[model samples]
Every structure is written in structure tokens, then in C-alpha cells.
Target: MSAPQHPAHAQVPHVLAAEPPRSRPSSIEHELPKVGKIVFRVQGIPLEVTLEGLEKSFKSHFKRSNSQENTIDTGLSSLVPCCYGSGHQTALIQFQPQTPKRLESLAPGRCYDFEDPDFQCRITIDQDFMGSTQLYPTISNLRIEADVVAIPGINGHAYGSWTGASKQNRKTMWLRDFMRKDFHTCRTMIFGYHSALLEHYAHTMSDYTEDLLQEVTRARGNAEEMGRPIIFMGHSFGGILITHSIVKAWISKQPGRLCGSILNNFKGAIFFGTPHQGLQHLDELLEAVKKNQGRKALLESIKFGNRDLEDTLSAFKRYCQETKLEVVSIKESRETRKATKGELGELARNGELVMFVAVAFSELKLPENLETTAMAEGDHSSLIYEQGGYV
Candidate 1:
């Protein structure tokens, strides 16, 4: 018997190298953080507190601390808390870079460790500050008007999914190769998150959407990028995430704010192999990975159908009606197989049989779109790494 063979297109080599980013700022500038401001998550404070109360609590803990009384700390430039009733109990602190370690020393774990009856919650540094710092193209001479933002699926690395050191090191990412030849003029930013979907501390889609908004705002800073056209590219579960973010922008009362700006910047989106409808069988997937498997987070996050997916899709359809944001959906044509319980058992019985073959094809029940293309030769994962084919 002959071994399974890939399509002719799959054999094509990635001959093109990634191009260097533009030196001058084009229509958009990817803003890097200056050491002037630091954002912190102030959790545990009662959600019912007034804006004034929130600020006062922060000041008491950071400024007039139990350790140091009567003296106001001069290092803090200002504390900007979120809106009074906003679910996010957070504050942004602008301070001198000279006292970098002061905030940590005060909060220890970035959580307020002080004993305050009114505000007893812990404070931690925002993920935007620690791990997923926005890294976009450096400001060049060009006056950038628009750009692209790419987000990877579950457990997908910000850089790796689109470029080097892929999740499994199987192939070079198509995004890297695509950008060089097709969308060279666009300034691209790859968004990353802590998508540990199964862990007790795992973040949900809403959390990811919020973080994405914050990251984009942080990267753009005071720049006026919202008025310009923006293109979004999401792969796998990222498609759902980007969709939710856009919907949030639409429903947001403050269209002038960061979340609003994200949606207001009308443009298009390209989704690759995103399960628009939903996946089936959480139990079987979980069984495959076992309780403590590393990929458990991903399966747990994506398992079967959930309300989040349906609600987001509904919102997405509404958002499309209200705006002219172009949509593109790409579905994979090839089928891939996985090991199954019965098949695995048979394999174990027959020493010659190495693995089970539970074959399946994956595709989205694509929402209405400006264009829909099918990658005839590609499967779920291969379509993503199809080397410069589509952008």
C-alpha cells in the first residue's frame, strides 16, 4: 500500500524571507509604552463604591499607607480610575520612571496587601504590563492612516502562530510570508493572551476581548488611528474573539473610547478555519487529553457549543448590518483524523497498528460575507500555515 500523500501545492517551498518593517510611520504608528505610566488591576474593592471612593481607597493604600503616615508620596503623578460603575475595578497610575520599583514594593504581589476593612481585595499588575506588551512597527516617517491586527487561536503565541517557531514546529506561518509580498504597506500587530482555557484562572472570551481593546489602545497611545481603516485577521478561535471585540465596540455607549474606537475604525476581517457554528463533544476531547494534559486548556476553552459563541455570532450579524465592515471567510477542504477510544483499543490489540483514525473535516458555517474561499487542498491546521497563499 502507498503512504498518504499531500497535495502538490503543499510541497511548495517558502522561498521568500520576511521583509523588514517600514522605518517611517505610515498611516498608523505602533506606539510603544514609555515608562511614564503604569496600569494596575485593583481587585477586591467593592464594586458598589463611587468613583471618589475608589480613588480615595487607592490613595490611602498607595499614598498615605499604614507604613508611612501623614506624608503624601510624590512619585505618583496621578491616578485615573475606570468609570464609577464599570465592572473593571482598575486604575492607571502615571508616575516618574525614576521610582520604577516603588509600586511593586508597595503592593508586593501587585495586589494591595494592606489591611483595610473597606478595600480588602488584592491588586495585581495588568497582563498588558507584564507579558503581552504590544510590539508593533516602530514609528517611521510616513503618516500612517490604517493597518492590520492578527490574533492567533487558543494557546497560540503572538509571534509564533504567524511566523517563526510554530506551535508544533510543523511549517512556516503563512502570515509572515504573506505580509512580505501581499500586504507590505500595512503595519501589522499580532495580539497575544493568556488563553489557558481550562485552568481555574483561565480567562474567558470577554476577558480576552477587553485585554485586546486595552492592548490596541496602549499601543496606539494618543494617536488618531481610529479614523483610519483597520483590517483584522484572526485564525481558529481568534475569529470568535475578534468578532466579540467588534460587537463590544458597537454596543459600547462610549464610541469615542478605546473599545468604541476599535469598532468605529470601519474595515474588513479575514477569518481562517474559524468554527463559526460550534464544536461538538467536550467529553470525548477531554478524554483524549486526560485530566492533566497540557492541551486540556485549549479543548476546555473550545469544547462543543456554548452560549458565548452563539451570542457573539448573533451580535456579529447585527454589527454587520449597522456598518459596511467587509467580511471574508476561508474554509479548509481537507479532512484530518484523530485517535479515538475504539480505534485506540484496536491499535493496542494489534501491535502493528500504531494509532487510531477518526477522520473529520472542519469548516465554518460561514456567516454572510463579501467573499468566501475554499482551500481545497488544506485541512484545519494546514490552511493556516499555507505559506503566503492568502492574507
Candidate 2:
């Protein structure tokens, strides 16, 4: 598919100088670490503080020291914590070269009491462990460099969705193998989150967005191509998460210390089998849930034909216009147990450039205003595996 023409809409120009010079790549470049991760278990995690909230508090910890002229070296590439279980919190902090001393200060057998206007919380560090080094294979020999971050859909596996499923025992995972075998210079990372669609509890897309923002900030430290372009790839519901994350960052005024680099440097996005326009298949899903007396939250969440979708796409389009972002929308082909709404063309409706591709078995009718291409023999997931289909 050739690139879509830039839309003739009101312009939102980007200010090049507004971005920091340090955020750009330097002449002297260094390769990213082969493999690295560090984790700590802290008890007495405040119940009131969500992961995003906790991350904000942690950022404050660094800002305060920097203001005092006693800057703490906090070089975490990503700070992702396991689900709070029994009031105990476990976080995997990925970094490059070495772990941050500020994090190390949260050592085992240490206790800290934090006070605030809203609430006071106490933390007891129980254990700390150095993450293994051989989790991911090395790519230091690659010539080109790009940060490729993948986000899985609802109830999807972070590693499995891209690497291929475990039980099948496939010799090569799509993402890992593709990058390793095809494009040696690309560095890949999976953005994982809790996306169970039918949970008894309630969680909005905004919550998931915040979770992704936390991971993006944490991963920023270890990015091999920090100054280079970043590709935000999302599958199914993962697309929604990416959209919300950017909007959330914008809403927060692009706080200099929180995911500002990601927003500034993000150059492109690839959405797979995503329901950018409401999920037309949702009516049947809601019907089934209504018959079985499912949770109201789930019902309300998937209700189609809402203004939320339009509002989000509008914001995304505005950002793309400002940054000249490249967007690729891929729809599924072939029928499954249930159909998913896959009208994602609007993501590129107002963008300067876009590649709209459709996989075989997909019956989606592309908008007449946009040019689209079809894959001869591919399904929703298989399309991504195709060479040059995603890259």
C-alpha cells in the first residue's frame, strides 16, 4: 500500500525547539544492553495508590533530590510492578549498565514512612533480587536501530502474542524471530497489562493507559535507540491502550519527567485487528452477556456507537498532524468463533501518511476516501507474521 495523502484540515504545527536537545541521539552512540532486570518486594504498599499513582510519587522522590542539588541516579528503563497481592508489591525494574542507587536504597529490611496531604503510607522492604541477564538474545551486531514496543490485546500474553504461543512449541515466534532473523537492528519489548474483558471488578481504558505510561517511562532508560524513532505496535484492544496513553500524557501537559520523551519521539504506530470505530460485533456479545446476567461494567464498557471513540480518534489525529506520525492499520481476514469490529481506517483519515492493508477473510469495507490493499492469504494474526507486512 502506498502512503495516504495528507488530509486538508486545519493545521496543528509542532515546535521543533520545544523539544530538549538531550532527547535526540548524539554522534557517539552506544548499543543497548543484551539483557537486564532487577526486582524488589515491598510490603505495606498503600491500597489507595495505584501503580501510576505510585510511579508519580516515585518521580517526585527524584525531582525533590534534583532540586536540592543532590541528584540521585535513577536510570530505570522500565519500572513495572506485579499486581498488588496481599498488600505485598513486587516490581521488575529494567535498566542499562547498572541499577539505580535510589532503587537500591529500598533495600531488604528497610522501612520507610511517606506522608502526604491526601494520605500517609508505610513501606517495608522484604527482599531484593538481581534480574537474570540471559532472558533476551543479544543484538549488538545489528546495523540499524529502532525501538519496537508491542502491546497485546485483552487476555493476551505479552511474550506469547509476539513470540508465538507456548503449548504449540513453534520454532520461531513472530516478533522475536522476525526482528532477530529479518531486521537485526530492531530492539523489541512487550508491554503487558491486565486486560481481562469479563472481570468481576471494574477497570477503565484510562487505567490501562496509565499502566502503559508507567512501563514506557521505565523502559526509556534502557532504550537502545532513544534518540531514534519509536514504533508503537498494538493488537486488538491494545490499540485502545496506546491511544489512551498518548491522550493521557497530553492531558497531563507532557510533564517533563513522565513519558515526555516517548510522546516527543514516537514517530509511528501499527494497529492490528483493532476496533478503532465501535466494535459492531459487540451487540451480540452484549446480548449473550445480558442473557446470562453478566456484570454491568462489562456491558457498559463495550456499548458501541459512543462519542468516546470519536473524541479519542480526534485527539490522536491532532497529535499525528503535529508530529507527522506514520500510521499503519491492518484488519483481519477469515472468520473466527466470534467477529471483532475492525474499522480502524479513521486512525489515518486525517493523517499526513498512512498504509491501510487488509488481510484475507476480512469483509471490512474500506472507506472510499482511503486507498487500501489486501493480503492474498492471511488472517488477522497471520498478517503480522508476513514479511514487510508489519515492518
Highest-lDDT candidate: 1
Model 1 reaches what TM-score against the true structure? 0.53
| Cα lDDT listed for each candidate | 0.48, 0.45
Worst 10 residues of 2 by lDDT: 4-13
* Model 2 ranges with Cα > 4 A deviation: 2-135, 141-144, 163-171, 222-228, 287-303, 339-376, 381-391
Q: What C-alpha lDDT does candidate 2 achieve relative to the native structure?
A: 0.45
| Predicted structure with the largest TM-score when compared to the true one | 1
- How many Å off is the CA of 383 in candidate 2? 4.5
User: Candidate 2's error at 148, in angstroms?
Assistant: 1.0
Model 1: how large is the Cα RMSD against the reference? 13.7
Q: Candidate 1 on 1-391: residue-level lDDT in tens?
A: 1211221122111111123333332211122223223334333345465445655554555563334432212332122223222343433333333223445455322343455557555544332322232222323565554556777766455544553223333233334333423444455556767543333344655777888777766555444655556677777777777888877766775645586566667577777667665555344445644654555654555544667667777778767756745566655565533323355321111112211111221233334443334443355445554321111
Against the true structure, candidate 2 reaches a TM-score of 0.52
Poorly placed runs, candidate 1 (over 4 Å): 1-141, 164-171, 196-200, 288-304, 339-371, 386-391
